[model samples]
Target: MNHARKVHIALNVTDVNRSVEFYRTAFGVEPVKWKPGYAKFDITEPPLNLTLNHQANIEGKGALNHLGIEVSSTAEVLAAKQRLREAGLEVIDEMNVDCCFALQDKIWITDPDGYRWEIFMVKVQDTQPDLTVPQGQHLQACCRQ
Candidate 1:
């Protein structure tokens, strides 16, 4: 596999400082570029180019579906969960859960703008491609054992 470039995403936030703090705590890294009403994070291992730009018309701008970071190990997932919790952020943990056709251990965190961020580690690959989760239950909420 020749994955060569980082994924870039720019988000419009009502408050830049708050979002920066939240992402900094969640990713355990500081933004490579930070300025008034703008910030950029150059994540290496995950290869993400995340940017937050302050805007007055942030509302009614269509919500982001969600964002996720896939890690390599269970320990990494647990560490990220702990770090988020320590930063006074609400984290929901799902261990050994099947989601998106893969078994994973993950933690979910919602940002100030209601953008959900999931940190996960895949443990198993699913052979079946069923996409139906139960009614009133989400993929993130499927790990109740």
Candidate 2:
């Protein structure tokens, strides 16, 4: 089987500078490339690529549904939460939470456009037989209820 490589996430936003500031404060990194209407950050210490683009109708488009970043340990997750809070950003904690048949410790935040983002540490992987059902059910159930 071919191995999957790196993943890049492109996010559309209303203002590049504001989004850049939010991400920089939240993730503790600076964009490697930045221009008038675009910015890109290599969040590889956490192994993720984050890109931001400026557009007029970012809110109307609903460009970002939600995205997740998984860290190495629960301490890292809590640390991230504290950092965000210190920057005057709201961070939602969901520790010991069951989702997709596995237990996770996580924190949630939203960007300026109200796009949900999750930073988490996976403590256990579930060996469930019905993967699809569990995945869908968990996403719906966990956030709402």
Candidate 3:
């Protein structure tokens, strides 16, 4: 079928219930479908089809550095921050921070599985010099984290 205007990501989580709760809070919406070991969230704002699959013995980082939604305006970012806060999740804010070659206003939320989700708005866009990483350092360090 036509899948335009949407992005799909399936994540393997150790706990289905916990992931469902986390995503519900993060997206400000419940899963459109939920089963014993699977949950799917169809988010409209950013048009995402995110699914969580219950899996044991997850190896490696499993969770990546982070996932983010680029909002249209700062107002939208603030609204998202408010919604996540109202859901009783600890939200961290990064205002006017230069990251990823752009000036951004953003907030961060961590799921129980240690996956980080960022809600941000691009305030200014410009070419930024390439950043070099030091030995034994991770890419996250240069990401304005």
Model 2 residue 40 distance off true place after TM-score fit, in angstroms: 25
Candidate closest to the true structure, highest lDDT:
3
lDDT of 1 by residue, 1-145 (tens): 1223455455666666788889999888997655555566868767886767666554676524346676768888899999999999999999888654458788888889777777776677442434332323211222122
Regions of candidate 1 where Cα sits further than 4 Å from its true position: 1-63, 127-145
Ranking by TM-score: 3, 2, 1
**What is candidate 2's lDDT per residue for 1-145, written digit by digit as tens?**
1112234465767766778889999889987656545565767566675667555675667655357676778888899999999999989999998753447788988889776778776576543423332211212223321
Worst 10 residues of 3 by lDDT: 133-142
Residue pairs in clash, model 3 = none
Model 1 has an lDDT value of 0.65
lDDT of 3 by residue, 1-145 (tens): 1223445455767776788889999999998756545555879987986767655546775743357666677777799889999999999999999754458788988899877778776676533434332333222212335
Quote each prediction's TM-score.
Answer: 0.48, 0.49, 0.50
Relative to the true structure, how large is the alpha-carbon lDDT of every model?
0.65, 0.65, 0.66
Better of 1 and 2 by TM-score: 2
Q: Which stretches of candidate 3 lie over 4 Å from their true place?
A: 1-59, 127-141
Model 1: how far residue 54 lies from native, Å: 30
Consecutive 10-residue window with the lowest summed lDDT within model 2: 133-142
Each model's Cα RMSD: 13.1, 12.5, 12.6
